[model samples]
Target: MSSEDFPAAVPIPVLATQPVVLASGSQTRLSLLRGAGLEVVAHRPGVDEEEVKLSCKAGGLTVEETAEALAELKASRVAAKVPAAYVIGADQMLECEGRWFDKPEDRAGAAEQLRALSGRTHRLVTTAVLFHNNSRVWHQTDQAKLTMRTLSDDFIERYLDAAGDAVLTSVGGYQLEALGAQLFTRVAGDHFTILGLPLLPLLGFLRVRGVLPS
Candidate 1:
């Protein structure tokens, strides 16, 4: 059969099984929802991620807590937009020691990030919150610890040359699932968690909410 004539695969199960709204402007999050067979409409929350992180840091919240709060904020914002639909909001933070890392603004910033994370185990805390009818029905946080191998200045430069602006997209200077995989010596956590969703738990929540077939 020609590619166009091939039947579509069955969609992944989701709670409600009905269409839902996803808050935030992340393509990664959108792809994750699509992979799970959910009909998701994307809504970008107009919050400044950096500002939220700074406020959370000033308030002395842990990285994990900050991530969840931001997720909730995004969900709340979008939930207001579509009051009758189920909404999902997600946020991620990278922390080393007590320091919070923001998304690098440029290649130089990414290089600096790589240098700071070198030879250290950093935690990536990803949080997701579900809102329905303007109420938070469920939430979860997935935390992953990744240790980056120390690289020489030459290697860092080469990596930056190869990865370019892609490095600035995530909180850390690398995308573990791509070419950035070469930068890590050890990683401990669920693959989905590293990707910033905690898929299984989120799926479980969806199933319990009747959004996915039981």
Candidate 2:
């Protein structure tokens, strides 16, 4: 929410000479950026994700490619408005046994998704794209594998009730950083990538572009 210009009393210095903008409203991604010492402004890119996903699927694009396409699409939309800044767009997809999952539309959907993912190994595909001057400059795709413990119907209901509406924020109705951890028996991937942002890779790209210290 705050800009890069911190008061002199603060020790933190502005990291980016080129302005940075995040073309997504994800609080997780925002925290990841700010926590890494990059002052960033977040914007809603307003891209129709379902449409993009459907189009990509129809066109025979793999889930990884679809993730990148969705990420770049969001970044490009925002970059068009703020051509001078590095606009970051990101997206995450959840897949299990060839089925793709989207964020739950309601409590019932959340329960349903949980049931489907129960006792299974699923992959989370995350993509991050950077655009400047309305053109794609950088992008990366990363994935994490998670295996959920076999959940009983009663347990699923209780988990859904406990997670509340917050479960609807991410695909697969789980947030690995929070109560969702109980749902998993095993996880393999970068912690940040599981949260739906490739923070390390994105930071590496920013450093290479001279927007961050070497």
What is the Cα-based lDDT of residue 83 in candidate 1?
A: 84
Q: What shift in Å separates residue 56 of candidate 1 from its native position after superposition?
A: 1.3
lDDT by residue for model 1 (1-214), tens: 6898988886566444688888988888888888877878999989888888889889989888999999999999999989898888999888898788988999889989989999999999989999998999999998999999998889999999998888988888888889889999999999988887878898887788777887
Report backbone clashes per prediction: 9, 0
Question: How does each model score on lDDT?
Answer: 0.88, 0.91
Q: Give the local distance difference test score of model 1.
A: 0.88
lDDT of 2 by residue, 85-153 (tens): 999999999999999999999999999999999999999999999998878988899999999999999
TM-score of 2: 0.92
